[model samples]
Target: MIDSSAFQGKKAIYYTLGCKLNFSETSTFGKMLADMGVVTAEKGERADICLINTCSVTEVADHKCRQAIHKMAREHPGAFIIVTGCYAQLETEKVSKIAGVDLVLGSNEKADLIQYLNDAFIHRAEGTTLHAFHAVKTKDIKRFQPSCSKGNRTRYFLKVQDGCNYFCTYCTIPYARGLSRSPSIASLVAQAEEAAAEGGKEIVLTGVNIGDFGTTTHERFIDLVKALDGVEGIKRFRISSLEPDLIDDELIEYCAGSRAFMPHFHIPLQSGSDMVLKLMHRRYDSALFARKIALIKRLMPDAFIGVDVMVGSRGERPEFFEACYRFLDGLPVTQLHVFPYSERPGTSALTIPYVVDEKEKKLRSKRLLAMSEEKTHAFYEQYIGTERPVLFEKAHRGKAMHGFTDNYIRVELPPSLARDAYDNEIMSIRLGGFNHDGTALKAELT
Candidate 1:
């Protein structure tokens, strides 16, 4: 049994890696600890507990997780360490052997972290080591733990769904996160209401496969959108990544005229070559993706569209890559998130005979990245003289305050006007040319 008094006044530090979903989960965990009277540790201070949320989207990500764990262990000596997230779910044994790790929790098990921490503290007080592991098999991961929390930024992330049913050939997400699952629509709306009550102005819907929401409940994604649109006090809402085939006409039409939904969309076009997409076992083809982009442009011309493109997967011949580049060049997307493919163990991708060399993969990624910059710059230039509603965030380094427009353009105000008074406040501002650093567009009061 845990001593209830043991948790009071304890200091804890959290380190999170990977997607916005992980950040939301970490935030929720922080609240849980806070309720027990544990406070966040200050920078460079040793804490009584250390929690690390990890990601394993790629081999490089796995290496980073390992490095972060080692660094945390060294910095907070004698603190009870807990590791969880996708990396821990897939590599329980490997994470368990890490020198300072006291416990390993899987995707599902992470929801019950408070109880595990209590047990760990009990064992520690008795002069016993508590290196425990708890993980549910992928197929058996059914519980959906809802999370709605703010990051260091102004916008809050609401996890509307979790897990994925479509296991792409080169992906390990389904293995690490489990099948599609989500809580009821009423539950999600309640969470959104709570966020609004807390003075949140923006909320971004996050999930492993959000468009595939309503797997557990009989609700549809469009229905959920309509319900959230009725939420008051939230000035903005942005839909994260959606599958191409799932961006139905109804959803697109609704967002174009919705009260709070912003004019921004992130759709993954893993590859522009239909042949390569087929090898990856992606449900939709390149033509379908192109049509979706065209429809979005037709409905909301000024909307910012972001595309995720992975280069150099197995069997992506030179001609296939050339075709992909051409297809992307013809699209009207605002930005391209380019990544070089990384092979993972136990994936069907290894059975494919062809493989792009490292040099070629890097070259391909570089080309796409250059194209992405050009596309984004042109998109930003188009609205140079226009006025848009921008929600400014807190200033950093006491320097400049940055914010995003309704269409997702990053804008910066001069340090002179970047006052604390403007933080989290939405104002009409005339967009100007690039700032001194060229990282964001300069803005002036309208």
Candidate 2:
């Protein structure tokens, strides 16, 4: 029903909120618009259409979404505003009432936004709302087809999986993203091969619950990695955030043996206390989480291990906090992503008793963050005076170039090294010493 002629050269701007998955989806949407002859422009610049991909993981995300819509409306009043993603899907009534939100599309209907816009402009209506709330049926949800070209990225995000099956007590992803689904092994391999052929040095396999991958397919996460290992041109592959319960010995061992996969694992621990884990409805206890970390250490001793922890959750006492600190202090983790607990609407944790005081939450967050710094510095110290493979990215912050070593240490190279290695090209570099901040390593081309 869309008359494509009306939008031939209209400029479009997109803003993304939330995780890597959201970014990947936004990039895919951008490519679609480009194919339709829509020019992509910088945010805050004049454009005919403004697309805001929103996140509703927390109340703060909701506030930011409203702020973005208002700001964009003020900058370009006549531009059509389209709101989509988890926040729009879950809080349709509230989002629709926002002053500048001209159209609201749910997750499934997001792909059809351009066509809807074309139709709306041709017909000249006040506005339109296409809220497709039906749970994305397995067939209705297209297997993540790579719509964009791969040569653009030194590292490409291949969405091998989608949706979450686990309904964590403090999470709403299950309701917002629907059930777990993944493409067939053949489809995933084809996509990875395309990225490899396009000169992508690393392919980060991302998803809502990547560990929950293969629930729909007979193939498991390890199986997918093994399949990708055979793909040529891709120097490395990385797994995004995964649940502690799914970090098995087999996957760790496979990563250890594989040349293509990087020696890094990002697992979310959420909480260290067994009581808190139970309250959060997490699948693994502290013991199991500890064992998983141990297995990764045993297989790949120098592997960069990242942990995700939430501070100030319901029923977390001082003893519980100390338990978390002690566990992390003794672990071989490279870094920690600490988050202060924030209430989200429709989540059970929001209504739970024993909420920590706001001041106490800030105190606990600071303590954990300090511990995280200590752990990160210790991890980076291990790679000093060693030669490791680094995938150099574009130069930034003056003449310095930055990249990540195989062990996931951030390395800074002088501008000279920047020319030989294109963005995402893997090369060997010898680490000189740690910077004063302890966050990165100073390195020279070997």
Candidate 3:
């Protein structure tokens, strides 16, 4: 047993890198520390503890995590630095060996953070030089730890699920996060209710494989969507990235007419080429994906559809790249989240004969990104004269405030009209042309 008094008046700082799921978990960890009387360290003040949540989706992500670990150690000398998340889980030994990491906790060990902190403090005091480490030898995704982020941000992230079951080639998420699992729909609904009661107007449902919800609970993803739709006080809800195959007609129909669900969808179609998708071991083909997009647009024509496309993967010859480019050109997506495929160790993709070189990978990625920009610009241009409701987020007094429309269009209010009073309020606005930078649409109060 540890004495709670030892943690009183401790100051801690948190840094998060990667997806919204990591942000949600970091908030939960901060809350856990707060309950133990740990307050956030003031700006420029040295904290007694440092917590880093990392991501390892790609080789570049791994390099960034290492740089972050070193930077945190240098800035806050002697602070009890702790590292966790996908990067820490997958590369436990390497993270533990980092100069300033005092403890390396795996994905499953994060729930018991306080106890680990106590152990770390005691060991450090006893002149133990070695870093403390705790992780499962064989990953277990069975445990479902519910987390909701209620930080200073305008939108709250509700983590309804964790882990991934789809072991796609060229991916290490399964090895890092374990298999697919999620909490009961009833529990997630209760969490959304609590967030609403706390004045959260927007909540983004986050998960490793959200469409695979109820892998453990045996409830369907559509059923979870129906339950959350009934939660009052939440003005907007957005579903995160989901697999193309799991998106059924029932769910699309519900969101089309639902009270709170937004007219936004982020679907991952890693490759537009059917052959490349087969090589990647993705469940759905290009035809099935195209059908889903068509259905969503038919029901919600003004919907904002975002796609995830990976370029230069194994077996993606020049002809396949051209095929993917042509296929995407025909789609009506609003945006594309593009990235070059990185080789992850211990994956089946390494066995494939053909591999894309660095220069070719860069060229392929550039072509796809250029195409994505054109589509996004065209999508924004179509809604220039329309009216939509935008929920403005909090911003500094002198800075321009921004918000997202129901269809996920980013609208900016000029600095003159950006008042503290308008923060966190939804209002009707006439959408205008792109602002000075063409980054977002300009808007004015109706």
What is the TM-score (0 to 1) of candidate 2? 0.92
Model 1, stretches more than 4 Å misplaced?
1-3
* Lowest lDDT block of 10, candidate 3: 137-146
TM-score of each: 0.99, 0.92, 0.98
Best by TM-score: 1
Candidate order by decreasing TM-score = 1, 3, 2
lDDT per residue as tens, model 1, 1-446: 54557799899999999988999889989988888889999987889899999999999999999998999899999988999999999999899999999999998899888889998888878999899888989999887888898856788999999999998999999999999999988998999999999989999999989999998887899999999999999989999889998899999999999999999999999999999999999999988898889899999999999999999999999999999999999999999999899999989999999999999999999999999999999999999999999999998765988999999999999888788878889999999999986779999887
Tens digits of lDDT, candidate 2, 39-140: 886645798888888888877898898888888778877787888778887877678778777787766677676776776675554454333222243235
Candidate number with greatest lDDT: 1
Query: 2 or 3: which has the higher lDDT?
Result: 3
**Clash number for model 2?**
0
